[model samples]
Target: MGLGAGPPAVKRRSFTRASVAVAVAVGLVLAGACGGGGGDGDGDGDGDGSLSVGVLLPGGGASRFGQFDGPLIEKQLKRLCPDCPAPTIAATSDPAVQRQQLESMITRRVDVLVLAAVDPQLLRPSVEAAHRAGIPVVAYDRLAQGPISGYVTFDGTTVGRLQGEALLKAMGTKARGGQIVMMNGATTDPNAGWFKRGALSVLQGKVKIGKSYDTVGWRPENAFVNMTRAIAALGAGDIDGVLAANDSLAGAVVAALNAAEVRPLPPITGQDADLAGVRRIVRGDQYMTVYKPFEPAATAAAKMAVALGRGRTVGSIATGTVDSATTKNIPAVLLPSVPVTVGNIKGTLVKDGMYTIDQICTPALRSACAKAGLTR
Candidate 1:
């Protein structure tokens, strides 16, 4: 949700397939030579022909992208198709970088390309190029419009409602008369709008929205600047809560509040139970984060990509389908999310094997972890 290719700006110039594709292929061959296949899916553990898969992530800046999405996806791809060419993966912080990565994957003629687009519309042509090349593109996380063979992401509305409900609960006695700020994600992302709509469904009349801002790039720094402005306009004491779209933005919000010296900080909500966010909850700085298990979601995407690569239907890969604005009734894997508060940090993230106690409790947070009942 943090990924934004900036504003629509100049719609992608007419794509030059031959120009970008050739360069991309050369780059891939060089990178592949260095990325030893090892036990990666290149082995076709299932005794099938070797498969080649490519994955392009939006950014590595969002800690979750590197820490959770990357390894989980690589591990699952190998489990689903041990003989597939070791999966090719890369991260680009900008849309232009993602476009170059897309073209390279296409040039390599990968069996399937899995993308968590930085900007779906601009990436549409690249996805279409893959389609024309007889390659299927599995839209992972953010839906990239095209003849997408499959889609995998947590239910957007459900994730939003969970965040909303948690925010209200955290507000407790303040819920009745409190005014809060809404720090949402980039408007370019359809998921961001879905999150806002779902949250408004519950937050509409119950709480007074003092100020709302659609974050520029889902960047913490952007959220920080915006939060600082909100504090200046609304005064620190009057704001009772914050609705940060994700853990990254939530962290920014908390930092801004801390700078403003907001004592007994107001309740804030976030998604993507990031370790820092969980640690903050233990120390009682932030309120909660939504834990959307990465394993099942990653597994579903890998299975779909492998199935598509082998010229098979996504029947086994999808639990259902979703209707997108540009595309109707797309094959999809809808994952569930759980709201995580200080009281249940262990029961959710720790128990799910998402993060170990050691990974979570550093020397600085050791005491806080103990206070949260996480001592082992």
Candidate 2:
């Protein structure tokens, strides 16, 4: 997660001060290259028998990026290619930083890149550069622009629809022409648009959208500010439910509702079955969160990266193809997602081994967990 330690140091060049400085400087460059570099490949274009995978994750506050996707992808890659070098994994919320990281990976000549772009449009040039360098890019989790060879992610529309349907269920009678707020993810992410489209398909004509905001950076603070403003505009009593883009935004929305002293908080929908989100559901704060199983998607991405690195076709592994803003008919594997409520925590997260009962039912949550029938 921390990109491991820097590569080992090189020996001193000479006793002279200048030589020593040169050696140290050269050592740092070598360290960076080694840390980020992929395995060597022959001109045959199939990379050497040993493949190096460069994985770029879009930040880590979501929990899944560091806790599940990173480790699971590494494990699957090892299973598929024992001799493959450990993936050069990097993550940052800043779009510029992510772009620089992608360029570094491309310069290192990594056979393949697995990228979850922080900003799809901003990363297009770098993705194009990778393509020019003959490195296949596999867009992971989020579909990126520019000549991507493959993609692996859950059905974005389905995820949003599930969240919308669950919010309606939680709202019950109020769902009949109720007033709801929409907290969408960053506009930079293509999936945000897909999710909004899908949620609109279910929520339109059925509910009054009192307020909607496109959160920047997908940051909780941004969501909090938006939610607080929404609360001010709509007043507590007028709001019936909230359509939160993900668990992080959901948390922020809940915080704002609490700050406004709204008693008996309205139903809130979220995606990414983050632990905090799950606990919030048990405590009756959040209505539900969509669980997009990470293992299968991670496995598929790893296998695709490996296959692409080996100059092999991903058709065998990709279940379908997707078109991006800049690319068409790109091979893809779109997994399914499940809406998780307090009642199905055990049947979903627990059963999937994403969490243990003890992990969810902490001492503080014992009573809540018991009431939710999550004990033992």
RMSD of each: 10.1, 14.2
Model 1 agreement with the true structure over 242-288: per-residue lDDT tens digits: 99999889999999999999998999999889888888888888898
lDDT of each: 0.76, 0.80
lDDT of 1: 0.76
For model 2, the superposed segments whose C-alpha errors exceed 4 Å read 1-48
Tens digit of lDDT per residue, candidate 2, span 110-224?
9899999998878999999999999999999888889999888877777788888888888899888999999998888878877887798899989999999989989999999
